[model samples]
Target: LLDGVRGWLMAGAEPLQRLAAMPTQLWRDVSESTRSRSDLENEIALLDQENLLLKGQMQTFWSLQEENRRLRAALNAAQPLEQDLLLAEAIPVKGDARRQFVLVNRGSRDGVFVGQAALVAEGLLGQVLHVGPRTAEILLLSDDTHAVPVRIARTGQRAIAQGTGNGERMEILYLPSNADVKEGDVLVTSGLGGIFPPGYPVATVSAIAEAAGGDFARVSARPLAPVDDVREVLLLWMRDTVSADLPKTDHAP
Candidate 1:
């Protein structure tokens, strides 16, 4: 009877010992699982950061490719031009927003001069205003004080296009109500002022409003040049085709 009682006591104690160890084993398993989950979360965050960086790099690469294409197209356009062309990069000056002028990399040292015509692949850009040693300021077509002598390509009717202090629009002044002007009429430099070369595109008529009983019509035009976004420009050394004794009334302001 004593031996049997001792064996039964041993068996019962073994079960109690296993029951006491259950809490520790459960805590260890939970801790391992939590650590694994935290590590996975950290790895996923790192991957997301890398993905965003790669996307930003891809956008920059695409922008560079587009810029390269535009540069090539500009070069091709300049190849057959009659005037002497000097390639220059332009940067917008930081100042009043209404001032529509840009600083070009070329200047007096590069033979740039005041009143020189500037152009891009699209059309006429502006006229050179001030020239420094290494840079020049170009008065854009959209400056409030700027004006260009333009003629309607369809009828050869002469008129003046004045800047409205707006980059997207210009005003054609002195057009009679019965003038042969219409929407979508192309305006080109008429060689009357002799500042800008003749036959260069200036703007396209966008709107026409006849003033009630007034002599002049209110006409609006959009510049053909990418005035708001042009980065590269060609400074033209136009030949002396027009006489210098020509009237300066139509000259650019």
Candidate 2:
């Protein structure tokens, strides 16, 4: 009887011991799971940071690529020109709508002078209005006070293109009501004023309004050169005879 009782006691004590050990085992498992989750969260945060860094780098890469393309295009445009060309970086001058102009790195020290013509890859941009020691100011063709003599490429019709203070539009003045002008006609510099070179694209005819009895037609044109967006310019040194009659003034006309 005593032996059977001892066996029962042993079985009961074994179960109690296993129950006491279960809490410790469960705590250890929970600690391991928590550690694994913490590690996973830390890894995720690190990846996010890396992703942002790469995105920023990509933006810089795209910007550099665009700048390189622009420089190459400008160089190609300068190669075929017969005139002496100087490449200069243009900096925009803000404020004062009446004085719409840009300053270039080239100046009097670099042989830049008043009345020098400035061009972009597309076409004529403007004329140099003032020259300093290290910088020169160029008067944009879109300034209200600016004007250029132009001829219609299709019909050889001559007229004066005056700026409307808007970068995208200009007015063709003194065309007869019966003039052979139409939309999409290209207007090029006639070189009559002696400030700009001949045959360079100036503007394109966009619209025309003619009055029944008026002698002149109201013509609107869009400038060929991106006057507001140009970042680089080519300064041309024309023959002395061409620029000899150019007027020197604080403001260009």
lDDT of each: 0.80, 0.81
Candidate 2 lDDT over 1-253, as tens digits, reads 9999999999989989989999998999999999999999999999999999999999999987875675455445432444556678877667576677889887766778898888887777889999997899999899999999988988988999998999999999988889999899999888897777777788899998865698888999999889878788877776453244323433211
Clashes of 1: 0
Give every collision pair in model 2.
none
The Cα RMSD in angstroms, rounded to one decimal, for candidate 1 relative to the true structure is: 10.3
Off by over 4 Å in 1: 1-82, 241-253
Error of 1 at 202 (Å): 0.8
**Distance from true position, residue 91, model 2, in Å?**
1.9
Model 1 residue 144 CA deviation (Å) reads 0.7
- Name model 2 segments beyond 4 Å from true: 1-82, 241-253
TM-scores for candidates 1 onward, in order: 0.63, 0.64
